[model samples]
Target: MEAEIITIGDELLIGQTVDTNSAYLGQKLGSIGISVSRKTAIRDNESAILQAIAESQSRCNILIITGGLGPTKDDITKKTLCKYFNCGMRRDLTVIDHLEKIFAERGRQLLETNLVQADLPETCITLQNNVGTAPGMWFDQNNKILISLPGVPVEVYHLIEESILPKLQETLQLPIVEHRTLVTLQKAESLLSKDLEEFENTLPKSLSLAYLPNFNMVKLRLSQKANVASDLIIDEYFDKLIATIHDDVFCLGDKDPATHLSEHLIREGITFTTAESCTGGFIANRLMQTPGISSVFPGSIVCYSNDVKISELGVDPNIIETYGAVSEPCALAMANGVREKFNTQLSIATTGIAGPDGGTKEKPVGLVYIAVSTESQSICKKFRLFGNREQIIQRSSNAAIWMAKQVLTIPL
Candidate 1:
């Protein structure tokens, strides 16, 4: 089945708030074999909302809309929906009761405006909102489904998961969909595509492959939608594909790069620390973002200034003077110093000129040096990255983590 998402709000159009709801819905729909054909973001004006709805209904079998469902007058989605369905607005007693109970329990007085939450289109089915006051509405017209949900993320998620998804599955018998993702590092997308050209061409008609690429890593996702049991065939193809990319493949399954690195460090009982300059603690922040990372990741230091690098990471002043703070020598010193200071089994370090400024003749902007240190050895390398300040910082941090992961894989 195909669906279109319409995310409505002045905030989204004005760039005040991001439309993350559509992305979440699209991914969930894709996993269930429902392709999201189009996504639109519009202001809360009636004309724009009507136009979006009409366009979506004309092109897709299902239309999912979120936003503009507040109790205030500016929230005109309910009124607009009533007009679109050619129906009158009626007060839903169940919704009113729920709203009253929630407000009473919280010791808040209900105002006239709050009563507007109970109004719904007469032609639609009201889906109970267990978590909020705005109930979801489902409309069926000409064998197409239209669902209107609250703008709040939590409310929309619960309605979709608890009510809408089950109803959709029952109404439409969908094919069994399965997907497997393989993660690899240190390879560009173009190079990987060239290497896998023949493998992709030989794939069965029932299966589809996509390459999702990011900094320093690529995810190979294989998807199949069919009624028959095709695990054996898919596995045979994936096994051959993995064999061709064995040297670069980092992990199997749909985990991120940090998850793989964290698992490896935890499994090997290796403690880790980072000393960052240009990356500005991004590497440490990413590692900390994953759960159970504290078991392996102790902490990190942001040594942005040359004085701090010399003092905190114990980099020699002479090395800084001779090779500069962004050089390989300083990077190696930072890695080894942090490993010793934290008594960690391994450590990573990054120093670079992430720029729109701070470029010299020899050391231009985006000149980064990354180092990884183990008990026995410390390795450092330089890179002339390309991008703005934030991108340069992000790329440098990813490169440092990738190096650390690579070093950890070496047999001691």
Candidate 2:
């Protein structure tokens, strides 16, 4: 079924609050074979909400509205929806009781505004909100399903999973949707697209490929919407894509490169650590995000300064003085030193000039050197990236992770 999401808030337009609800809703709806045709963010005004609802009803079968459902003056979504449906407000006793219990549990007084939150459109069915005071509304108008939800992320998540999805399944005949994502690095998006041109051309109408690129990595997602042989067909295409670029593929799923590396380190009982310079513990931070990584990854050294690089990671003072801190030799030494210091089987090191300043003609900004080391051998690569300081640091960290994966797969 076709769907559209309307995220209502002035904060989203002003960039004070990001509209993450649409992404979450789109993904959830897509998983149930519902395609999100369009997503729109509008100000928290009655006219805007009415216009958005009118436009969405013309285009889609399912319309989802999020935000502006709070117990305050600017909270107009519930009233707007009532006006659109030409219905008067009705105070739901059950919701009032729910609110009272919530307030009592929290040891807070229920104000008049909090009680007014229980009021709903007379024509719509109220969807219970277990996590919050605001209740979701479901309106079936002329066969088009309109669902209005609260703006809070956690509450929205629970409502969708616990109530909305189940209701959708009960009402609609949803096709089985299957998606396979392959994470890859070292290739630009244009180049990867050219390489996969033939594979994409051969894909059936039911199957679609989307390239989601971030930093230096690309996520190749293959989706299929059908009931019969969907998984088998998707897997067949997935294997073909992997075979075409097996070396670049990090893992055959949505998880990041750090996650796969951590899993491998844990499975093979290999220890790891990082010696970070310009990346400023970014490499270590990404690895630490993976759960239980502490078992294999003991710790890391973030030597941002020359003194710390010399003292903590034991890089030679002469190496920094001669070839400079951002050079390949310094990266290699840092990698080797960290591997030895942590007493680990593997280690990653990054050093670079991620800057808007402090760059020479010889060593420009985004000049990064990444090194991966084992007890027997050390490998370092030079990268001349282009971006702001944060972007350069992020790309450098991704490069380090990719290099670590490559080093672990190869024998010393």
Candidate 3:
């Protein structure tokens, strides 16, 4: 099966609101073995909505429309849908009763505008909204399905789960769909794609690969939707794909870098700490983002100033005066100090000049020295990055985290 998503909103078109509904719907439809062919975001105009509906109906078996459903002047989706379906608007008593109960329980007064939300297209079946006043609409016409949902994400989720999904299961024939994602860092998209070209081309017809890149990492997702049992075949391809990119693979699954690091540390029974300068505890925060990390992560010290480096992290003042704060020696000293202070086997330290200023002939902006130290081994590397203040800090933080992971993988 194939589907298309039409997000109707002037706010979304003008960048005032983000249309997360399209992605959510597309993923949901995919899980039901319905592949989304296209996604369109249009303004809250009657002509635009009509055009989208006509265009999408011609090509897709299922068309999902969201937004423009509100008890306000600008909300005209229901009225437009009524016109398109050659029907009139009618008040739904079931919706009105649901809303009345909600308002009474909340101790709020209902206005005429609120009552207007009960109006829906006569030709479409009303799907009950459990959490909100606006009811979802489902129309099956000419062997095609069209579903209209409210713009609020939580309300949309509620209606989709409680009312829409069951009806879809009854109306459409779907196949089994599954997905597997692997996270890899320190590899560019171009390089990864080039390495996986042969592997992707050799995959079975039911499987597809997706490259989802982030600021410092890439997520390689493999999806399969078919009637035949392809689980073993899919796993085999996944193993091959990971083997092809073995050098760059960090962890297998949808978990982020922080979660993967936390699980790895927990499994290895290792404790860790952080000492930061320009990154200002960003690495520490990322490490602690995963739950149950408090037992392994002792603490972090942010020595942003030269005085703090000397007094807090116990960096030698003479070293800072001789080679500057953002130097390899300073970074090593910070890492060793934190690891010894916490008595942990692993520690990550960052010292960088992340700025649009504070550069010179010898030391330029975005000059960073990251150090990852263990009880037996410690290493430090200097980087010359190029970005503004925030980007520099972020890059430095990512580098430090990656360095720590790389250290653990090394065979001492």
lDDT of candidates 1 onward, in order: 0.87, 0.90, 0.86
TM-score of model number 3? 0.88
RMSD of 2: 2.1
Scored by lDDT, model 2 comes in at: 0.90
Which portions of model 2 show Cα errors greater than 4 Å? 227-232, 410-412
Which predicted model would earn the best lDDT?
2
Superposed Cα deviation of residue 256, candidate 2 (Å) = 1.4
Q: What is the Cα-based lDDT of residue 106 in candidate 3? A: 97
Q: lDDT-based ranking, best first?
A: 2, 1, 3
Q: Write the per-residue lDDT of candidate 1 for residues 350-397, one digit (tens) a residue.
A: 998999999999999989999999998899988888889998887787
Q: For candidate 3, lDDT tens digit of each residue in 9-114?
A: 9999889998888778877777778889999999989999999999999998789899999999899999999989999988999999999999999999988989
TM-score of 2: 0.95
| C-alpha lDDT (0 to 100) for residue 26 of candidate 2 | 88
Total backbone collisions, model 3 = 0
Candidate 2 vs candidate 3: the lDDT winner is: 2
Model 2, 1-412: lDDT tens digits are 8999999999999999887888899899998899899999999999989999999899888999999999999999988998899999999999999999999999999999899889999999999999999999999979999999999999999999999999999999889889999898778999999989998999989889999999999999999888765344888888888888777788878888877777788778889999998999988888888777878898999999999999988899999999999999999999999999989999999999999898999999999999999987899999998899999998998888888866677211
- lDDT-best of 1 and 2: 2
How would the candidate models be sorted by TM-score, starting from the highest? 2, 1, 3
Model 3, residue 214: distance off in Å is: 2.2
- Stretches off by above 4 angstroms in model 3 are 104-107, 230-232, 266-269, 341-345, 384-391, 409-412
